[model samples]
Target chain A: MMDKIIRDNYQRETKIIDAVYPRTYRDSTIVHSDRLQCVYDVFTYTGDRLNDEGVKMNLMFLHGSGMNRFIWDYYVAHLLDYKLGAAINKIVTLDQVTHGDSSVLNRGKLGVGYDWSDGARDACKVAQKEFYSGLEDNSDDIINIVVGHSMGGFQAMCCGVLLPSLFDFIVTIEPVAYSPNVPNNSNVTVLPPKFFKAIASKVEDEFKNEAEYDKFMHERSFFTKTHPEIFERFKETERINMEDGSIRTKMERRQEMLCYMTLHPTSYWLLDGAKHIKVPVVSLVGGIATWAPKENQQVLQKSIPNYTVDVVPQGDHLMNIEMPDEMLKRLSVHFTKFAKEYQSKNYDNSNKSVARREEIFEEIYKETERNRVKNGKPVLAKL
Target chain B: MMDKIIRDNYQRETKIIDAVYPRTYRDSTIVHSDRLQCVYDVFTYTGDRLNDEGVKMNLMFLHGSGMNRFIWDYYVAHLLDYKLGAAINKIVTLDQVTHGDSSVLNRGKLGVGYDWSDGARDACKVAQKEFYSGLEDNSDDIINIVVGHSMGGFQAMCCGVLLPSLFDFIVTIEPVAYSPNVPNNSNVTVLPPKFFKAIASKVEDEFKNEAEYDKFMHERSFFTKTHPEIFERFKETERINMEDGSIRTKMERRQEMLCYMTLHPTSYWLLDGAKHIKVPVVSLVGGIATWAPKENQQVLQKSIPNYTVDVVPQGDHLMNIEMPDEMLKRLSVHFTKFAKEYQSKNYDNSNKSVARREEIFEEIYKETERNRVKNGKPVLAKL
Candidate 1:
């Protein structure tokens, strides 16, 4: 039913742009994908000057479900100013394939190979195509940053591994990284195959009609109790309507299910990728107490040796939306430090460049190792 | 424009019903009044029958805007259990005229005299009507407490004065009582008429078209960002809709304006009312340093000689929603003490109920007074 709705309502249009800002830009396009055949959209901001001495930053933003790119409005607005001021080099953000104006997938889209990693890969492809294309044309220096929240957090980790060269820094907010040792069959961790089968069979049987399907979606969606005001806004921008008066998501339901279902590798893959990378990484975890557990943080810190995690005290999974100023402040601090390090190399033409980088990397590794030890855990193997 | 959208999309057939429990048989009714032209739901849980041996304690609840009686779901679900079983006698809740499935009033439908005072009066009427109806129907006996939050706090204050007989104890959560003499309105108390006009104009402009209006209502209403999940559920329940391709609010814009535009008389009116009321009153103020000035509390304490005020740390206007456990804990403490006094009076015929009640009330009042004096300013009064 969701798939049919997406097919009926999905619409996409793209226009190339000469410039978004800063770098005498050219070749910009917008893509609209369907989630469950509903129209989902993504706006790509491609760099203009490929050979400029600019630090390329790839920002893959993952918005929570029921919201779109508008959640990043403040950040985007700031980026516009940053670009003009040359404060930032370049940025690329996409509506998650299942969320924003992206396409909705079908329920059949679930399983090991079709999970969040696929979504991250899709996002990486978009960034690689845009940034790599710019690099290919102009040879501009590129530094990648991947950021996501909730499901987006899951994707950010996926992208960290799938496109290791593309992202030097990765930040995830409240990533739902369940431990492999913990029972995945629990309702809170992952829906068991039996539960999925029941839900799928029920949806197939009861939601044959668009209205029934839409009603079912509204009823079962995690955001069922969302404020009417917000739900209405989401409806206006995030969903597409069918000719039969039924509605479906623009992103593929299958993609969304794939994002949730394929978590077998755990976030360990991303942690391993982080070990191989030579860039700084940070994660902002909202300490909601009710949702994100301390165990998850412990696991992430244990696996990822070169990552700094800051827990925002009274924040939820949507920390970026709920506490934008705090999130921005922390991000700015990390970025400024990275920028300084990148610039410092120019003044010191010492052969210690590799050694200095290694030293910083070793410092991060030591801190993470100490943390693991203090928390009564085994030391992670160095990359 | 909002007024028109409400008129177009208002659900006239909506009804409120009480959830009856076996232990406590509370009388509940849904009144469809032409004055508001919507359902006014009232739930009255009579005190547990103690064979006229226990004191009657009545708690009148006033929930915040954009929330129905469901906001007190925790109170009903947890607090009212055995923890508070021996402390209180009865609990009563009413859906204010324009809120919940309560009566939806359009502009000019309620007489020109309508305002916050009128809202209080309407709530009092419901309480009294329920009280009398319960008495006639032999629904448990007791009337002693009044609890409200935000706008409900204001209503609770008004009810305290207008219906003094109904409550022997009161709990107000962040009640905004304006003080005309306070310098500069430092507490941001005097919400300028311009603010309301600006919002009204925005609402009017946004709701020009039915579809557009519905969309606008959904995005701008209080329900938008606060609790998206609940809002979606409401939409699914058909309690709210975006059917016209525009957002139509379940609540009338005029009613919302009435809440913000209207202010309780800040001067001697409240003080004098407080003076006339012999009931013990506890005002729970959220320590929203950004929004609440320190001077307001001093003024409030000075005005109500018998009043006890508590400053909840790191709390906001939505304290009930934000810190329900704390609020419930404080309320339970006070109610327990009151219940003990009543029980003592019954057990020992020589015990003076008035003296005992005054003793506890005086202790709370004196403590609050000292805190206010020490803080060096009347914060609540200033606001």
Candidate 2:
């Protein structure tokens, strides 16, 4: 029924975009730029592209760690069938380099570890090529919104910062962003990255068969509350068949562990980089305190100038999978409100004035240069 | 002249105490505990131990990075000669491993990289053995005070947290502690750890002769304002005579680089560990902005419960060497005030009440455990 609804409401196309695997830190000029094909799904609306409000939103969905683009299958279907007051021209979903179909394509070409900024770089490229290729800046009626969960949620915010002009709005659900500045207000303290890495090291790599994998996942509490339909999609897309007919999870355990390890530094970078995001950001956090405390969401609200955090009742980290309807309701309300605001506000005010993000970036770059000491000599000597 | 004053006013003894080289992270129980000899110097006052105000104080001075206990020579001489309205029973100073004479003694036995908490552990063991050993809890008449500069300053705060009962006060001088929570009010943004590591890697490790080393150092602006006598002491004691008649800095360049790399994590750890410190902390910052920003000192002021930041006029990062008189005057005033306050306040109130630090530590430990997921199974499963 869900597949039929999705098939009838939208025209789906599997597309691949060129992406670069960055080598240097902070996306510095020194990059290998290993050309890889990043696979994504695009769903174009068959009905009226513009809603009653006469506004169109083009959204790109990004999955979290160890998950694939198909995790959004249920949510996308609901959005396409029930526009929920906001019109959608198209919806896009991505599979990260080492997850799902992208994992198979970039099997041996993957980098040693994940540089989170690389994800932002790839997403920016995709958004530019897919949505803004021939459109004039500020002329395109389509509002570009990037919605992501967990790790992808962090990347969505990064996308806004890396290219502030690209994204119009960003929605992150339970982003694994931790800031040292904020106190953990949950009942328990969040464990450090090392502990998560240790747990990742021990994740089940392979199963005898799909049924066995299903049984194993069902036993784990992390996926117990996942909607049955979403669970089926996750089980099908999150793993691949082995040569011997067994199955293995798409994301390598080592890669997952590496992702967990990079969480701290990358999260801190996001906290520092968030101030540059000139777009509105709304974070949908789980009301139920789980791995990520509710206060963790405040990191974005505190740093970003225009940011809000909404708590989904009885929702957990996997709220998108567990209660897609609740997430959809909040998304529709937020996108409608944001679309009206964007129409009323002078969106071109920033472009006419100084590009504050670029200015701040330049300021930070110069400041870093001035503070550096080279060869036992200070460039601008002080004390 | 300084040597004559120091020799006449105090009875000095070189002491060696046992210390452990921690191997595990966070000084976890899984440690090698490689036994090592930590060396220190004791300067017992020859005059009346108690001040006119009827208070006795025992002082321990810890040197900053790339420095030894001898860095305190001028400061110690001044303190011994002029009591500064306060009396001192004895003054002690330490040479951290890989920095001074201890570097030569512990040659080839040092651990790879630095675990900052190990410094606190060593200092705690030394404090308990030297000052508090055989003394009944809350019965010791001498108020123990620890004064550390830069890296040692950070360690002094750690010392207070690790064993709060040992030290009555902690004074940190332009400590290398940086917290992301504080807005760096200085004109420039401080360079990250990687930049410092690069600088450390390029430092001149070996000098042809003492005169060449002196000439090289004098050419750099970093040491231009250093007091001539203190600069002489620094040049003489900071380096060691090599086997080929050349001179090499006591601390290895690679070790120093590792120390720089560990600064970020260790500083964050200090921010978290600082709340546990029940004693008063005074951070002496340089009025002249140099490598360490004045706002960087505010990290301690914000996190620590009973902490204060004092700016020393015309002083920089190496204020202890550049303006020892200014540092000494502030120390005398702060210490004198602290001593009098300690005498008036109920010093044993915390001991009689709940041990808050231990309770917090246990709470964090249990929280970590509850939040940890082992073998794909959360101990206290949620979501």
Candidate 3:
């Protein structure tokens, strides 16, 4: 079932990969007892980074909801096809808290408690520690392109807001944001800070074996867009083998919903956050009538100064996973365009700063009240 | 796990359903079949066809690839929410030949031999024998609606062409057609009475037990949009429990590719066939850059006079299986519009014809040559 196109041949050389960012985010609001650290993978090509005259860019791939960094192995392995066997200088991918290997390392405490907003917060921290810090010496000399789908797209936006100059270009594929037109689910958390139980009460959380889960996922319509190996990769990285010899998703059900609940307020923060993005941003709409309201992008385009929208008509929210080639094609074009423009201007690291770091956290919580007053969306508050 | 909204409370009733159209399309030039018939299920509302005052119509739903008639159970079972326990009067759904009970009945002969074109041929024959003949009495007083996804969409076009007057309206969802932009795989099946064996040498065919296959398919991303019972229903109808204690898909892997190959030439036949559709037709694009070429839909819209397109943003080729609500929403809008317009001018069944039935087979082969001469996609002539 493993697609050779995605994980074999030249790919066979750089197959096994994992990175553990040792710094734990101790202040996680939702999972009070849990200690979570960022886990990521760095994919370096068969040869050294293209230092010579060649079209090169660094990539940070952000995965969507309930997905681990390993899901990105498909793109990392296949992006080599964009060129004969090289394009990116360094590829960095990460697992958000309550997801993938990071949660497994947290032991049993990484429960159904982590929120969506915390994911963005943790993502920013990881990018700062793993990627941005690594670029401390070179700084803005190299172009860093962030390609994200779904929740990763949402977190990419947070990364943009937190460190405006870190990523030179960002591509968002089917990231959900606040849409006034979409009716709020009735289970939105109330002010006393009690957690909302899982809406997914009926979802089967465990399978008898690997083939069972594999066949379960393989038959669905969504994976028809994904290469089989990616799911195989996810199965390896994101599911746990229980004591009963059954496999279950790394994300527990209630905690998964809590991720949605915790990050619920940030949807309102997005339009306002659009003002802070100094870099060129591109939004990819998966389909016209998608889960993310088209109006969210419309509102974004209207609010932001430098923004463009790409419509990959054949894609759904998971198009990044569905059609990586088209997604890569878009990223390559954007990188080339931005590199040329920035190169012409002789852009440098002069404008970079840690000054916004303090203000960024304030912005996430500050906007919550403003949004609540405006009846934007229900905001999450601690107990 | 059943989604409460899709299958609970009201869904407990009407558990038994099955209808087999017995007449074999042995004359089908594409399949040279020993015997073949379409298997389908019919769902009648609580009080029969509410012909007295309901928004009366007869609906036929054709499923996508590797699927059978049982998938429609979700839509039929859940439609009660639209009108507090009632909606459409009669709903009919079918399994394409070489699938479901039809394949089971065909025994071992239903192998890589089944072609996609033959599927349309069989569907046309089923509609002719069961639907058209039944309507000989009620005729114009009733409206016939055909809704299909993926290959079903392609076959729906075939149905529209073969019997233009039989169906009053048709809706196509992410249906496969052809475009020169799409790269033909390395194997462009050349033909001259030779059977090209299965290209799927790598596919894992059988599991040790039904539990293994069941648990495997239960975990894939594609089925996220479908209700669990539909899959369970599919397992019941389409998979065979072998005597040696193993489970194999009723659809062999080779038959799937041959479905793509056998009908390869028909992509060129589509534009010409579109000219024959007199009824109002609507095409739903799954996404911008999907497996089904955007140019295919563009060409269809250009060729067909009475046609419209609705872009379902959140869907890929399997949109029918993913977000059925959105699919149904588009259908409802189309039905409402067509009903109001056709109501203004009384339409009748005088054009119904058996005379053209003989010509349908001749036309299939005739178009094959014209398409080949037009430098159509390489067709599998049968090896």
Which one wins on lDDT? 2
True lDDT of residue B178, candidate 1: 47
Ranking by lDDT: 2, 3, 1
Backbone clashes under 3 angstroms, per model: 85, 0, 32
Interface RMSD of 1: 37.6
Off by over 4 Å in 1: A1-383, B1-39, B42-56, B65-68, B85-90, B103-108, B111-113, B132-141, B179-239, B242-245, B264-268, B289-293, B347-383
Q: List the residue pairs that clash in candidate 2.
A: none
DockQ of each: 0.00, 0.02, 0.01
Q: Kindly indicate the candidate among 2 and 3 with the higher DockQ.
A: 2
| Model 2 C-alpha lDDT per residue in residues A42-129, reported as the tens digit of each score | 8877865457755567889988877788988787788754554457777888887767787767654454445565677677667756
- Per-residue lDDT of B219-249 in model 1, one digit per residue for the tens? 7644343333334444432244445544444
What is the iRMSD in Å for candidate 3? 36.4
Worst 10 residues of 1 chain A by lDDT: A23-32
Error of 2 at A68 (Å): 0.5
In order, candidate lDDTs are: 0.47, 0.66, 0.55
The best-first sequence of candidates by TM-score reads 2, 3, 1
True-vs-predicted CA distance for residue B299, candidate 1, Å: 2.7
